[model samples]
Target chain A: MKGILRSLLTVIKNTFIRSITVLYPYDRIIIPYNSRGSIRLVVDLDTKEIICDGCGECVNACPLKLISVEKVSHDKKIKNFYVDISRCLFCGLCEEACKKDALKMNFNYELAERDFSALRHDIDKLTEYAKPKVKEFWKS
Target chain B: MENRKIKDYEEIEGYDIYIEPQFRPFGFPVGLYIALKDGVIINIKPEFGYLTTGVEKVVEGMEIDKAIPFIDRVDSSSAISPELTYCIGLEKTFKIDVPLRAKFIRTALCELSRISSHLLWLTRLANVLGINNALHYCLREREEVLHLIELATGSRLTPNFIRVGGVASNLSPRFIEEFRKFFRSFRKNFNMLKTFFLENELVVNRLNNLGVLIEEDAKNLAITGPNLRALGIKKDVRIDDTYGIYDEISFKIPVGEKGDSLDRCIVRMGEIEQSTSIISQAFYKMPEGEIRTYTEDINQFSGNTRSHIECPHGELAMEISIDEGKITKLRIKSPSYNNLLAFSRAVLGESVEDVEVILTSFDICVCEVDK
Candidate 1:
């Protein structure tokens, strides 16, 4: 009975002393330094330039064929390189194939879409979504 | 051992016969221990099917290009490796060779991903063990690595930037300079991780000699990755099988002394150092070349092909059967699948509290296991 009491005390001490569990979302714990969150692509719209050739290379590169690149041409040259984010693998292939470096992967991870159509992002929307900003992380 | 058995009693028959307790009289992570009364475990289980998604089956019927996201979702923790492996497999099957510059960048980013994943795992491990400071420290460093990947590759987690025959494009001069700065930081953080993970008293206490799997056990089960390397065996798919520009850069395959949890951690930590070395070397000697593999004639194998890589997680193997260059059937084999075996061996005889750490030490991904 004495030994049992000692063990119970030890357990209680551990439970109380450890400040391990975080009240997430409210507390919003820091993700590890190298965490892989969500797939993001960057479009430098400040230059008003699209990086994707929209040749559908990423569309072809995907093992699933989920990507749909609908290219809009104004002049003889390309105008808009639209993409279906819903179908995109977020595999970074589009960014990989974006030889112009017009397509980059940004760290903005939260994309909880309400519907499939909402999941889709055209070139214009993608450009708007490509702003670079590191999310605030708590040290403690 | 002696055992005692009582004859069925009339008093217990109508009382609903409480065969098993309904409420788990323990922690959040419960251990399921089922065994024969003859001192043998019929089954030792953890109610660990929560983090499950049919990622593999999701990708099977989809086109090669469409399945990338589903593949990344397999293990949110280390999703990039799976996606990258699949892309490499496609490139090989399609007979596309990327440019020289693209190859260097892929090598750099892939190594960066490796460091990132390791840091995450280490932090998670620390979290479970009540080592808050260690967890925070590791998480901080891991963020920097992710930022570098984002700076270079664009996305923090799901950067599907590595295309077939080449990377989407090359880093700009400014970004390249910043990336070189990241290269130094990666090396510095990796060294810190090595020292902390390998030498920290609490980490050492929690990990070392806690689990034991000898060579024969690992061999019989065909376990791969850091777990296998922990047994002091060097069987990396990158070196042995040869994939990407891994053949180009000089990197060492770090191994450990024992097939214990500590050994596994040590191997992973040492691999981080090796990965860091590979990165710096690749960065400095990053030759001017294509980041992708180009294909002239897409009409190639017209059948099934298997490609393997020594990913940070383990020997990540991918199986894809193509009919006229469109991926028909895709199956993935991750290192976590083999490493899951270490659980029953590691957890048995130990108290239930150690289950989480042991589960973590193996780094078992439920998605990978189910897939």
Candidate 2:
């Protein structure tokens, strides 16, 4: 029974020590370097060049069929890419197939949206979402 | 009163426990379970896959190599592990070994993926336990690990780095240096997690004797990996000295004495440390070699094949029947399949409020279980 009291006392101590949890939305957590967030097709913003060869590999990879890479280049290339985060499991298989590193995983867990369509993005929008997290390691 | 000379319920080799004892779990099948309480768990009953999307069936009709991405979807979290298992299994069947460099990178990516998966499981359980602070912290570290994967493989989750023969690409020196730094930083912060939430007495109280899976029942249930270890059975496919370069490395397999919620947590934490050790060793010994070893001349020793991997959950066994370099049949038996027994047995005689604690303790993956 004394052990139970000690355990209770410990819980009380911890509760006091950890009462300062961040309120999540009003005060966001600065994501660490190792967080896995929504994935994106890598697009080089400097040149607007897409590394995907329009192979439809990613489209074929997704179980949910959340990706559709299309190429409007003169010869039906897979330059334009679309990913629907709503359906995407964030499995990272689509990025796995891209030999060019054109698609990448970036941390941005705040992907709450009321509209379902907002989850889907074209190649251009994916580039916007693909921003690298400038993780402040020392901040911790 | 029943005679003590007869079965004392405790002395019985096994006992049967229906999980949905209140009602038949057919129409409203959120979760279904059947536990054999032969002094522990004997057999597990699950019907989550009753309504199937037929992923494996669909793959049989598709082109062979095109199946990598589809395989990733089977259990979505750690796509790299499944991809590696399938790609390597296919390569082995065709007698194609990847370049030394690719093999090293493959192991590296696999460890990162395992860490990411454990992080997800940790957060999920912590969330269920109402410890949201740990969830954020775990996800934060998971993002760092994902970035390391991202730097090498491009995609964070579904890294298709490993092809049938060799890995598709290589990691840069700078990326390697950065990744090593990240691993070091993560190590420093890991111990604080225990202090953060694990040390909380309420958490331990909720988990203490809840969902107990004794030794004998664990073995009968075909329990493998950490779940088995949590039951005081030191059965780990990885340490069994099996395939996929595991023999080349040195590591300790952590085991638990009581198959309770706390023991399960200890096993997972021990795995985190052990996985880190393996990654560090793989990192130091990485060699440079051609990543892929398949020939364009498809006619190689290809018929039917199987390869095995020890995942964070347990033994990930895959069997493939190939025809003309294309996969005819691919059957995956994930470790998640056997864990249901442990989960269901742990929940019996448990307080209603502690159900989620037991469930989360088992680290049940709905997708993997359903798959």
Candidate 3:
């Protein structure tokens, strides 16, 4: 009988407390800056150009071989870069292996798609969502 | 009466046999075969192999550094323990020295994971017990711990934070501040939870004296963790085998006198308190230094080593054999596999209604079992 009263008191006290739930679609919680989200190509702040030199360090660093890099010539010019997000683990190995600060994991987590083909992100798709002026938290 | 066959098992005249197929609420596909007599359980046979990803086979021949992500998924709820065990095995084999700051951060993260894992168990137990309010409260506290992990490791469930020699990154200042805030309020909140759930008449009446496991039977079945501890055995991998900085940290191993379902719940609640104290101690004694040590050449190292740690479930150990940078063999001794055997034994002679209660009390992770 005492235990029942205590539990009832707790339930009553909880009624006055504010709810911690964030109603999704109506309101969104702020994601942390360093969260491992979708992969994106980092662009130079002034030049506005993708900073990848086509060195393929990220390709070697990736354990799953989801990243593919192509170079046009020996002058460090990138021809095509692609990332298959279908099976990406998002371990941030590619971002850590980039010596040129050209690759990063941005804070865009909403990557749901209806079609399977749209999941494969190319250089244009990667750069399309790239934030130019966002401070790099992983570097620190 | 003539003998008959049901689902490949011989059915006797006086007993009833049924197979409980995997359900959605159980979170994993682990079928249970129960043999009943007079509404009491005569036997229980657990089935596995429904969710096997063959993690050990896939990790073979891969570099030691590259296997962290794969290992982190073995037990996704408390991912840090397996990752830490794998890193410790490689570090011991290669004789690599981890920085002190990294060690402190690792210990803190481990305790945090333990707290979160236990809270998850509590949520499941509450759900099984039909206490919806307790489930909500447990989930709320678990979300706080997961958020802290996300703030530090960039991911919540699978942090993949621990590396071979040290951790991947240092603790941020915001994380430290939030941890302090969490530590301050968690004590009061947990007290409220205890009053709301553990001390309730419904939970006490339902769980007390149910599914009692004897110490001798538990030892025979090789049951570790709170289940064994509930039988008054003071056995813990963290204490017995002093891994990481556990020798430096001071914490009590909570044990229960009776090996009943309620005793298991009480022991885990005590453990949550001890884990919180451990995190605070690690935070206080944490030193400022490098988080990782750069190894010049890891491929030239070749040896075999084993490392073990006390996970939230029980003892989790990893055995690794490396041949000049490539892993030749990797074996994970998960606690849930042994706990499943113990569960099959503990469920005997109990009524059918208490089966879920006893199962959740053991807190068996089928993913770990099938891994």
**Top model number, TM-score:** 3
Q: What is the lDDT of residue A7 in candidate 2?
A: 39
Q: What is the TM-score of chain A alone in each candidate?
A: 0.57, 0.67, 0.87
Write down the DockQ of candidate 2: 0.10
Deviation (Å) of B22 in candidate 3:
3.0
For A22-100, candidate 2 gives per-residue lDDT tens digits of 6987987554343447776666678665556776766776656777766776774565677777766555666656667
- After aligning candidate 1 to the native by TM-score, how far in Å is the CA of B160 from where it should be? 1.1
By TM-score rank, best first, the candidates go: 3, 2, 1
Model 1 segments beyond 4 Å from truth? A1-140, B1-43, B46-52, B185-196, B293-301
- How would the docking of model 3 be graded? medium
Q: Fraction of true inter-chain Cα contacts (below 8 Å) kept per model?
A: 0.18, 0.05, 0.64
* Prediction 1 global C-alpha lDDT: 0.64
Of the two candidates 2 and 3, the one with more favorable DockQ, higher being better, is 3
Q: What DockQ score does model 3 reach against the true complex?
A: 0.60
Clashing pairs in 3: none
Q: Provide DockQ values for all models, in the order shown.
A: 0.13, 0.10, 0.60
Better of 2 and 3 by TM-score: 3
TM-score of 3: 0.95
